[model samples]
Every structure is written in C-alpha cells, then in structure tokens.
Target chain A: MSGIVIIGAGQAAGQAAASLRQEGFEGTITILGDEDSAPYQRPPLSKQYLSGEVGVDRLLVRPEKFYVDKNIDLKTGTRVGSIAPSEKSVTTTGGDRFEYDKLLIATGSRPRILNITGSDLEGIHYLRTMGDVDGIRESMGSASRICIVGGGYIGLEVAAVARTSGLDVTVLEMEDRILQRVTTPEMSAYYHQLHAGRGVNIMTNTTVSGFQGNGSVSAVLCGDEIIEADLVIVGIGIIPNVELAETAGLKCENGIVVDDHCRSSDPDIYAAGDCTNHPNPLLNRRLRLESVPNAMEQARVASANMLGGDRVYAAIPWFWSDQYELKLQMVGFSSDGDSSVIRGDKSTNEFAVFYLNDGKVVAVDAVNSPREFMVCKQLYGKAVNAPDLANPEFELKSLLN
Target chain B: MPQVKFIEFNGTEHVVDASKGESIMVAATNNLVPGIDADCGGECSCATCHVLIDADWQARLGARSEQEESMLDLNPDRTDESRLSCQIPMTDELDGITVRLPEFQY
Candidate 1:
C-alpha cells in the first residue's frame, strides 16, 4: 500500500507524488497544500508576474484536470499542523487527520521577516506566495517610494521592477554588497554597478533602524536619517519550515537532517526542499539548499527510494537567478573555493566565472553565458589546470559538449 | 523545417517541427516539449534536456564531445543511448529523428 501523504504542496511535495506514481507505486497518494491554489510556478512571481507580463492563472504549475487524471488527491486550503511519528499520521490545523504508510515533509520555507518597527505596516509586503504578490502588485500603483530591505536576488529583482515602475527605490543591506553571501566579491561588484546604473540606490553596510510613518510606513529609518517610502518589501532570506518536524521529534540541525536517500531519522518519513538538510557530496557538508532544482531532484529521489528503488540522492548543487534581462546560472558549491577565473566579457553581459579550490574546478557562475555554463557542468570534478580567466583557446565544446 | 516524432512514455505521439540550425533542445522548447526542461537555456549546465536518441538513428548523430560524454554520467537514468539534446545541433540529415525522454523528467 502506498498510502503516501505529502505535506506542504510546493514543487517538492507535488513532484514527489507525481514521481511516486511514475515509479509504478500503486499506493494511494495524498497531497496537502497550505495555499488555496494548486501547485503554481514560483520563479515567475518575481519576473513575469511582478513585471505584469502574466496573470495568476498562468502561474499554475499544471492544469487542474491533470491532477484528476493522475488519480492523486490534492487537498488545497489545508494547513498541516503537527505530525505524529509514532502513529504515522498528520493532524491538520482544521482538525483533520491523515494516516499514511509513508510521509514526505516538503513544508519548504517562509520569508524571513524584518524584526523592527513598521514591519506591521499596511503597505509593506514579503513576496513568497501568490497572495503576497497580489497584495504588493495592487499597492505598487499608488506607491511613490519603495524601500527594500536586503539586496539579495528577490529584493534586487523587486527594486529593479519598482524602479522601472517609476518609484523611488532604495535598498538597505547590512552586508558589504548584494548577494555577498552566495556569490563571489567580483560578481557582487558587477551587480552593484548594474543596479546603480539602473538608478536603484543600493546602500550596503546599512541596517534599518525603524519605520518612520505613524502606521502605514511613510518612510524607513536608517542610521541617522530617514528615507521617505510609501511601500516596503523585505527579502532578507528564508527560514526553513522546520517547526513541525522539530515538534514531531525529528533530528533537526540548521534544517531537518536527512540521509543521502532523503529519509528522515524516522525511517518511514522523508523530508525534501528547503526544510531538509542533506549530505552534499560535492560540498562535502550537510547543508540545506533553498533552490527549486535541489528541492525537485531530492523529492524525486526520495520517491524512488520509497518505492523500493535503489536510488541515492546524488547530484551536484546548482541554482539560478533572473534579474533585468540578465540570467545568472550557477553550478556546484563555490563557498570553499579560494580562486575564480572569468571566461568571457561580463561587460557585454555574457560571461562565466569558474571557481577553483586548489586547482580543481568546483563551481561556475554563468551570467547570460549558456555555452560556458554547459562546459562548467562537465568540468565540475576536473582539475583547474588552466586558470586563465581570458583563455579564448579553451574550447567549451571540447571541454564539455 | 522538418517534422520529427517524439514518443512519450505512455506512447503519446508528438509531431514537432525542427529548424535547420537550431538544436533539438531549442526545437523541443519551441514546441513546448513536456520533459526537456533546458533550464540553463540549453547551455548544458543543467542536464535537464537529456534524451535517448532512437536506436535506429543513433549512429546518424555525430559522436558526443568528451565534455558531453562526461556530462552524460550526471544524468539519473543514463544509458549508452543517452545524449543531451543541446549538443545535437539540428540539420536536414537529422530529420525524422525520434528521441526518448527519461521516465523521470515528467
């Protein structure tokens, strides 16, 4: 009996159910989604949706008819409260309980809120869901000034959109540069120029002291000054939705700790997505990836393992970001790298930066350069024999077809 | 433009048009092929555009690069028949090609 119950119906949860069926698992499958809508695409929220290129219906992950055709029970508008590991069941906040032979916790993550005054203001928004985007888009029209907290991908993307929409955009980041935590120093500097050239004021090493308005966030308070703002968007980071797993007595570290197979400490239970931290062979560390590809891959692998398939969750880490016609694609973990080399002209908006750890190619960040990005995927475990940044003779096809 | 037949796991037939110089990945993306994600814009950074060339016409396609050959190892259900659609540049000689997407891509 499959009797598989998946919680938090995002990409991972939805994919796990589909994968389980695809793997020939004949067991009953149930999906619980907190959002009222069916599984929808999230990446487009900041790009097409935020830019008003698409509508809510277009963001749907799949057609409603497909769920019925798959013989899967998708329960929307449902919030799974707590899990009972001993009983192998999940109790919903609305008092409904589901018993399962196997459980996959894909609760994912929530936007980390700014913990200062005026955070509770009316015009401020944290874009993690469709509901959040709807609110922000509706309020954006009348907004004269938009103050964004954090200069990460989400914040910068919103800043670009706000600036394009004719709003005075100011980004306050506590870090030295935008995307400093994830990308290289050089990459950060490049984006700094790109955003500033677009008329977005990026204030680094600055923290929000408080809010200036009486109730509805008219201005944001910085060190010794206040910047007028009619709208605020906080995109600091994300906190893993690990409270349910923790309350259920699962092994919890920075995220819910899972083995290579994506199975939690509770043998029958599995965890995927941002909520689960698994051993990364490439990184050689147990870390959580807040990326869609990682979440989707791990969920598929977990499904395979649950169905008696001898599949181990093994793949190099990769992530991507889209901002202002620039597509940045990254592969492998580059945090441990000591040196990096540029392969093309980033000024022309086409380049790949290869990260090397002791002469071994560990990671590559490609900005609008798909050819080198393809080569970097092939050269992941290869040694960095040629570390020259401007080597035109380095044929990417020969390196990686 | 040439028409190629794409056979799905459940035997659904999708006849798609292929441009002369565009890679199969680009053609599939143009036709909105279900499984070929081509996430990295077909740069090969992401192996999501993987497909197994039809056994009958496998030899018709050029030999995979050492890089493409190595990248094939990263694919989940990799077989000797496997090829990344991005690497196989489309041509008139490659018309009537049929490729099988891995079962996992859906």
Candidate 2:
C-alpha cells in the first residue's frame, strides 16, 4: 500500500509529501497535481513576474532535482477525480486508481469568475493559474488601456505592472474602498493614494455592469461610465475547489470543511491550504486563508498528523503583496477593530498600522514595514497598551522583546 | 573597493573585496556565501536572508526603516542585532564587519 498520497500539486501538497518523507515515512509517496508545472509560489506570480523583475524559473518552489533526490513521485498534470473512503483509494481524472494508507486533499482554490453578461468575451481573463498570468502578461504588451474588475491584490498588482509599462490602468470595485473587506480604511486610504499617484484610476463604490464588445472586451460599462479597454483582468477572489471533496461526501461549507488535524469528515482523508475551511484560533472563527504561509504551514501540520503524529495546524494567517515599490505585509485579521494607530507617514507610503480589538492588538498591516510586521505576528492577542503608535519614539522592537 | 572581514563560515574569517554601493546581502550572495538565501533577490520581500550585524557596526549602518522593521517582525526569534541583509547596504564605514546566521531558519 502507498504510505501516503496527496492530491493537488500546489505548495501544501508538495510540502506535505516532502514532510511525510522527512518525518520518516518510507513507503510510496504520490503527489497528484492538476497543473503541469511543478509547485511554484503564487504570490510572486502577481508581483515580480507581473513586473518582469523575476524570471519564470525562479517562481518554482523546488527544482525537479529536489523531487528526484527526495524520491517523491511528483505526478504533474494529473487530477484526482474522487476518493472512495471505504476502498481507501482515489480515482484520477484519467481513471487511474491509487490506494493509500493516508490521503491528503490539497486541491487548491480557483478564481471565481463573474457570472454576468459578456463574461465569456475574449481578452477577459481571470488571474489564477500560471496560464492566466501568461495570458495577462502577453496582452499587457499591446493593450493600451486595461480594466481590472476587482480591487483585490491580484487586480491592484496587475494594475501596478500595467501602469509601470505605460498602459492606462483603471481599477473598478463595487465596494466603497479598495481592500474594504480585507484591510482597515486607513490601509485603504494609503494604498488608494499610492495606486492613484501611480496614475491608476481606482474607481471604488462602482460596479462593472459587464464587458462591451462583439467578441472581445472593448469597454467595461459601469453605471453611466463606459471605460474603453483592450483587456480585462478579474481578480474578485477565489472559490475553494470543493467539488471533488463534496462529491466524495465530505462536509463542506464555504470551503472543504476540515477539523483541527486537517482531517475531512472522513478520518483517513485530510485537507489543507486555500481549499480547506478550518477553524482559526486567532479569529475565534472558521476562516479560510488564501496565503502561502497558511498553505505551507498547514501542509506541515497535516503531514505530521497523516503520519499518525499528533500535530494541530494553528498558525496566524500572514500575507504580503508587492505593488510597484511598496510592500504590504499583513498578519492576522484586521477586518473590524476598535481602533487603529498609524506608525508612520501614510503619504510617503512607509508605515505600519496596529489593529486593536477593544485594546488588544489583534492584527497589523505594515506598508513597506516588514520588520514591524514580523514582530506583530508574534504579539498577536497580546495586550499592547499603546496610546499612540505613531509616537516617533515608540519602537516596535521593544513591544516584541 | 573596501575589504570587509566575512567569516567564510569556515570558523576562520576571510576578507572579501566589496564595493560601497552594494548591499551586504548582495556582497555575500555575489561572493558565494552558502548561508544567505536572498529569495526576494534583494528586494526585502521574504525574510530568508537574515543575519546579525556586528555590535560595533550597528551605529554605522543607520536605523532600520519601518518597512524593514515590519519584515523583520515576521522573522521568527528575531533579535535587536537581527537585520535583513538586503537592507544593510555596504558603505565606506562598514569594513571589518561580521554577521552570524541562526542555527535553523525556523
């Protein structure tokens, strides 16, 4: 019997396979992935790759040689259709059968496309996979004006890239401000300023009716404003790829439902990464994190559990986004808080905002301030009595120490 | 070019020629130091390339920017001496400096 079998070839699956071996699971390890390419970092694909600062090769999480060295049977371009809990096996899309002692479902999420009119128009792309980036990157060359449907990280990141390349970029968001759902209004104002300063027309509280063109996206019609565009990148968000799990009779809510040990309703089957909706201790709620840190960490925790080792996957959700020269680093959920203190000048786009819930620091958003972000991730749930974080003499290092 | 003493990880220190314009991470990566994994490629995105600045050299390198501070905060078990090697650019006074990497990049 195969010692361990992990479905989905993304970071969580890749890490789980490797960790199982590292933890001394010598039996057959099979990692099934839908994508042909090896597991690569998705965060960089939107930033450095979009900016042309890093090459494609550097995006890979690990080289092909590492898999060979680790003796991991890295099965690329393979998709697992469903899992038979009673038989202790998985059936792939190609009808190949694989039996396993332990199963890990790391089937990651995919971009949620708008189901509206003109959604099928050409030149309208969703930024999710490697192929999507290639499509957007290629179109960016000739596209004079680009309309990004969502004001999320991916859309803003692509906007930065397009603006840098001298393409007129316009971001359309239905919300009152960009990142309204994810970050504080202070953060929204800061990022909004930075993007607008870069000549990115951020149109918030405005909805895109749909695309306008015969076969291709020529303009995005929102209200009365018909903005002409050569290309449209939709980065609204991602819906967990829970179809496989749901079909397999796994309990799924917003995402693939998993317990603390990352075990699906089936004891033998486990899930991790962006696809799984696990309970977050930090937020005291069930939260689905779509970040690399969460994916990689959960993979490690889940892999240990699969090996019969007791390990709980509890890590603060952390993510970073690079737009132009600004690095936005966030740790924990700062959605709705009692107050927030700005640590530096927002105009210069270099500062950290401490998100306080009733007096305790619940989360932090660091704009171009990574070290403070690093410290605050450790200080989560701590009673930080800071009257004013913007006090010039107040150092984040002391709070950490 | 200024000669700075980089403990070649051999326990014995060796002096390598570094230009003033380059960052310490750039100098170390360029000189083929095994420890520094400058994954962000000197952009200070990932905190992989972490190092401890020599106490005496701390005053000369100036203070860590708020951006650098936030990045370092994400670093596990960081120190006052902990500095993202990418942020510390080599300068005229940064000679004879030494840095040590943590046992495990945990």
Candidate 3:
C-alpha cells in the first residue's frame, strides 16, 4: 500500500498521524505542512505563548523524536501545490510528486485580513502563527498605546494581555456589544464591564474606517473619531483554507463539504478540521468549527475511517477563553437559543448562561464556573426546567442525570 | 528550580527539574514525558493532564480546589488522590514529587 498522506501539519493533521499509529496502522505516514515549525498548539499563541509564560518547546504536540520513533515522515515548510484525486497523487510547490492510498486535507484556516484602507500599514498585525505572535511581542515592548480592531476572543485576550503589561489598550467593536456574534448580550455585558474595569477602553458600535500614521500606524479612524495608538492588533476572524480542496474538484460551500465520517466527495480522499464544513446530527446542520477540540476530534474520526474502521464524528464541541483571570468555557452552540437562564451571580463574576431552544438545552457559556459548564455539557440537547436551571440554589451536579 | 518525577502507566519514569510558577503539566510536556496530554494548555478545562499523586506527596501539594476536583471527577479512572496536573504549580515543596499517569486521558 502507498499509505496515508496528510496535506496539513496542523492540529488535525498531527492528531491524525498519531491516531493512525495508535490504531495499529503500520503503513507509511507522511505529513506536509506549509509552516516551517512543527505541529504546535495554536490556542496558546495568544494567551500563554504571547505572554511569555510558555516557551516554544512546550507548544509542540509531540517531541521532534516522536515522528522518527513512529516512522512518520513530516515535511515542514513544504506546501502542496495541488491535489489530483483521480490519480491519488499530490504535487508540491517544490516540484515533488507523491501518491497515496488515502489522502487527508487538513489545510486548516488562515487569519482573515481586513481590506480596509491603510490595513497594510506598519505596526498593525494579526495574530495567527508563531511568527505573528513574535512580531506582536516585539512591538508590544516599545508600544504604550494599543488599539484592538475586533472584540472577539483573540482581540479580547490580546487586550487583556496588553493591559496587564501596562499598555493603554482600546478595543474597537462594530457591534453594539463585544462578543455579540457568538454570545448573548448578557455575557457580552459581563465582559464589557470586566475589560472596562481593568482600565481598558472598550468602544462598542465603533467601526474602524481606516488607519493613519507616518510609515507606522499611530491611530485608527473609528467612524467620525480617531483613536490614538502606537500599535494595532486586528482579530477580525479567520477564513478556512479551502482553495486547494476546491481546485481538486472537491465540493466547497462555506468550506470543503464533508460527511459525518469526514470523507469528501472522493472515495479515497477526506478532509477535517477548520477547513471542512461537516454535518452534525445533533444540531441538524453543518458546522465549521474553528476550535482545537473540533480539529482533534475530526482528525481521530478521519484517521479511523482512513484505516477502514466505521466511525462517525459526533463530538460535543467545547471552547475556552482565558482573559485576565477569568476562565470562560463554552459548550454547544447558542446561536439559535430562544431562551437563556443564568445560573450564578453576574455581579460576582462567577456565572454560567444556559441557552435553550424548544425547551432543550442547546448550549452553555460559563465564566469562572467550570463545574456548571461541565454539567451542562452532558445535558446537551436534553430538555431542562429553565427556572430550575436559573436557580443558583439548585444542585447542579444532581441535574446531570 | 524544583525536581519532579513523572511515571508512565507502562513503567517508564522521567525526572526533570521544573521551574517555579509553572504548572506540573508544563513540566511534563516540556520534558517530553509521555501520557500527559494537557490538551487545553493548563486551562483546567480539559482533564487530559490527569495524574494520581503519590500518597506521601499529596499533602505537600495542598488540597484540590472545587474547580479542580470537579474537573478530575470527569475522568473515569480518577482516584481519591487524583488531581489535574495542570492545577498544581511547581514549588519547592513539590520537589521530589511523583505523579503516576492514568491508563489514558482524553
């Protein structure tokens, strides 16, 4: 057999390689990553790594010797130019060709770049890769005033870090409240107060019309007003890397369309992670999650199916964000929640909001309350009494059943 | 710096010096010790860094907080001495501490 060849050295690809080996696949395994660095955790790039709490050595998913010991071929800094599914082969930018019995497209996602005027100005950066964080870190030292263009997790986390480092930080959000896109207004209000209380200026309903400076960004034009800044970090969001899969005749919608098994249109080809829009039976819709847990879970399912094992990717998606000292852990999706119940006291900064749709618990967003979040995660898609859920005195552990 | 020992379920042992203020999970992952996934990167959200502290060293590590205790409760193989390695910070008192790995952490 020609063995399995994965075309992305990210979280999904790394997990796929490891899971394949653990599943007793003795075939030749090869991974091609565009990045020069080995497969490392991306979650810490904004939190621990950016803050210099963790070193680069600790970010790796596995040690350098792991690939060698497992007999897996890892090609760093190698980009796959195109994929020919008909021939089961892939061509690289460096003019190399390889064939495989099974192929996985774990290309992942890229940071979304704003196309506004002066976006290319110096001193403005996006946090995505190791290099991006390094650039921001270098800029953070000499910069006293920092402006964040988005109020998402990345922007908020970076704001928290910058403020802790004694920088004057200002966050610009186009929405009426921060985290409005993914969270309820109540949750967003809590964060707004948290960041504002920490001496960070958070401007909601603020649009960054453009950037202004002499060679480097010194201020951002937010509508009618201009906010002064020595540095700017844009955390707009990310775009899934689907050009390669789309060009290879694979189905692509918002992302490369994959089944519950993580298989693409081609029989011998599969896709996973942030690049694939896979179907979720629980939600009754297709989801493209940009989370590490989603990536790793899909990779495991894809790896199993690649080895001819029948497995479906059914995972309860969970995400966590660390801002200052608050640990916000969210499970399930709360987009379509019709009703929400707050479990803990919001004034004390310890609470969890449970989202319900059609009387069933669809999601839970817990801040500084992991225990409630853990219990709510198990109750996904199950009906629960909202009053009881909102009652702080209720024993949450007993409701797990 | 404090020295910590991590023993895999398969009987492989690794002893390394750990820096103060960093979590024990960081020490294990930094030393390339196997079986301590710590997938959440010390967030205590994921219990991938589940470890059973040696009975003798349990007191020195102090009591587990309610959050840490609940996180460890998610693990099926958790024991009375079970603690999330990510929750324990490296200190001088934790030097010479031994934590045995679980059969698996997911």
Mind listing the fnat for each candidate? 0.05, 0.38, 0.24
lDDT of 3 at A261: 95
Full-model lDDT, candidate 1: 0.81
Output the TM-score of candidate 1.
0.84
Q: Write the per-residue lDDT of candidate 1 for residues A269-381, one digit (tens) a residue.
A: 99998899899876677888888888888888889887777778877778777778787878886676788878888789888888888888888888876556656666787
- Residues A218-317, candidate 2: write the lDDT tens digits: 9999978899999999989898999988988999998889988898999999999999999876577897878777787788889889888899877777
**Residue A342 accuracy (lDDT) in model 1:** 82
Candidate 1 wrongly placed segments (more than 4 Å): A387-389, B1-5, B8-47, B50-106
If scored against the real structure, what TM-score would every candidate get? 0.84, 0.84, 0.89
Residue-level lDDT tens digits of model 3 in A41-149: 9998999899999788778876667788779999999999999988999999999998999999999999888888888889999998998999999999999999999
Backbone clashes, each candidate = 4, 19, 0
Candidate of highest TM-score: 3
Measured with C-alpha atoms, the lDDT of residue B68 in candidate 3 is 90
Model 1 chain A worst lDDT window (10 residues): A392-401
Error of 1 at A262 (Å): 0.2
| Model 1 lDDT at residue A347 | 81
